[model samples]
Target chain A: AQTVTQSQPEMSVQEAETVTLSCTYDTSESDYYLFWYKQPPSRQMILVIRQEAYKQQNATENRFSVNFQKAAKSFSLKISDSQLGDAAMYFCAYRSGGSEKLVFGKGTKLTVNP
Target chain B: NAGVTQTPKFRVLKTGQSMTLLCAQDMNHEYMYWYRQDPGMGLRLIHYSVGEGTTAKGEVPDGYNVSRLKKQNFLLGLESAAPSQTSVYFCASRTSGGPSSYEQYFGPGTRLTVT
Candidate 1:
């Protein structure tokens, strides 16, 4: 079974500053996918970024990026130039290749202070 | 487009009561999933369907039933609600056929309180 872990339960960053959320996973499969999802108070789960295990290149989406260390089984999300809207609960998720189910971490509640 | 929509944004139920939560997607996705989000448990998949008239158990499927009779709709049912079942429910869908088909679009979750 695949499991995702987010060690930080809460994180805060000053506006315009950069923040990194840590995530680790346990999976035996060599081919899989990693994802970062954001959930605001609006209750919608939005995709932040995605990374495929075979690719060594990290995934970047606008201000969000991921540092995926396949050997360490670590996939961390970095938010650069953070804004107030970045304040939300961020979840790290994993899905094995060709599987429909996603395994998610507990979540990291991020606060962007102005 | 309303990518994915869940019915009854909020609901309060007593123990032993039964109800069905409906999820509809406008994107015509072939895969649909139901997940429950607890305070610290993140989102655990309860049930999922790969296509119409098909359903499968997920990580935590106990006490939950699901149906996908229609191509655009997925229904999750709780036979007997429990306090432990009180949590936010989210529905998601994604394209099934393609190389880059891992992205899932989520719905505005439905909060349920079982007292």
Candidate 2:
């Protein structure tokens, strides 16, 4: 079984600043996918970014980027130039290449301080 | 496109009552999933389907049942609801296999409260 862990329960970042939410996973498979999802007060799950374990180059999407270390089994999401709207509950998820299911972390509540 | 839609956005039921949640997607996805979101727990998969007329149990399928009679729709049913079942239920769908199959599109979610 694969499990994702988000060590930080809550994180706060000032507007225009940068913050990183740490996540780690336990998986025996070498080929898999990692994802970061954002759920605001609206309770809608939005994809922030994703990284393929086989790819060493970090994935960057606009102001969001991920530091994926496959050997360490660590995938962290970094939010830069944070805005108030960026405040949400962030989750880390993992999906094995051979499976259709996704395992998610507990979550990290991100607070953007204006 | 409406993407994905869930019927009965909110519902309240007494313990032992039964209810069904309908999830429909217009993306023609072959794989659909049912998940629950609790206070501290992010999201746990309850059941999923690979295609029409096929369903499989997920991590927390003990108290839930699901059916996928159509490729665009997935239904979750609770024969006897319990307070522990009070949470937000989410529906997701994705391609069966492809470059973008890793991504799952989610619905708005249905909030259910069993007292």
Candidate 3:
């Protein structure tokens, strides 16, 4: 079974600053997928970014980028130019190749203070 | 595109009560999943359907029953609701047959309380 771990339970960042949320996973499969999801107070789960294990270049979405170290089993998300809207419960998830299920981390609550 | 939608944004049930949570998607997806989210315990999959008329147990399926009679709709049933079941439930849908199939779109969750 694959497990994702987010060590930080909560995090805060000043407006316009940069923040990084750490994530690590345990998987024996060489091919898999990693994802970061955001859920606001509204309880809407939104996809932030995704990275494939085969890709050497980390995945990025505008201000959201990831530092994926496959050998270390680490995939961290970096939010540059953080804004108030970035405040949410960020969850790191893992899905093995050809599987439909997702294993998730406990998530880190992010607060962007102005 | 409405993506995915779960009926009854909020629900309350007493012990031993039975209720069904409905999940519908308009993306013509081939897969649908049910998950529960509890504080400090991320989301855990309860059940999922690969396609119409096909369903499988996920990580946690002991207290739940799911049916996917229709390709676009999936239903989860709790025969005897318990206080331990008080949490938010989420529905997700995704297409199969491509590299991007791993992308799953989630619906606005349903908050259920068993008193």
Task: List the RMSD of every prediction in angstroms.
Answer: 1.0, 1.0, 0.9
Winner by DockQ: 1
Clashing pairs in 2: none
For model 3, how does the per-residue alpha-carbon lDDT over B1-115 read when each residue is reduced to its tens digit? Answer: 7889999999999999999999999999999999999988899999999999999999989889999999999999999999999999999999986876878899999999999
Write one digit per residue (lDDT tens) for candidate 2, span A25-68. Answer: 99999889999999999988998899988899999999999998
Report the TM-score for the A-chain of model 3.
0.99
The residue-level lDDT of candidate 2 at B105 comes to: 90
Tens digit per residue, CA lDDT, model 3, A17-98: 9999999999999889999999999988899999989999999899999999999999999999999999999999999987
Candidate 1 local lDDT, A1-114, one digit each (tens) = 788999999999999999999999999999899999999989799989999999999999999999999999999999999999999999999999877789999999999999
lDDT of 1: 0.94
Q: Deviation in angstroms for A49 in model 2?
A: 0.7
What C-alpha lDDT, on a 0 to 100 scale, does residue B33 get in candidate 2? 96
DockQ comparisons of all candidates to the true complex? 0.87, 0.80, 0.85
Model 2 C-alpha lDDT per residue in residues B3-114, reported as the tens digit of each score: 9899989999999999999999999999999999998998999999999999999889988999998899999999999999999999999997778777899999999999
The local lDDT score (0 to 100) that residue B47 gets in candidate 3 is 97
Model 1 interface CAPRI class: high
> Which residue pairs collide, candidate 1?
none
Predicted candidate 3: what Cα RMSD to the true structure?
0.9
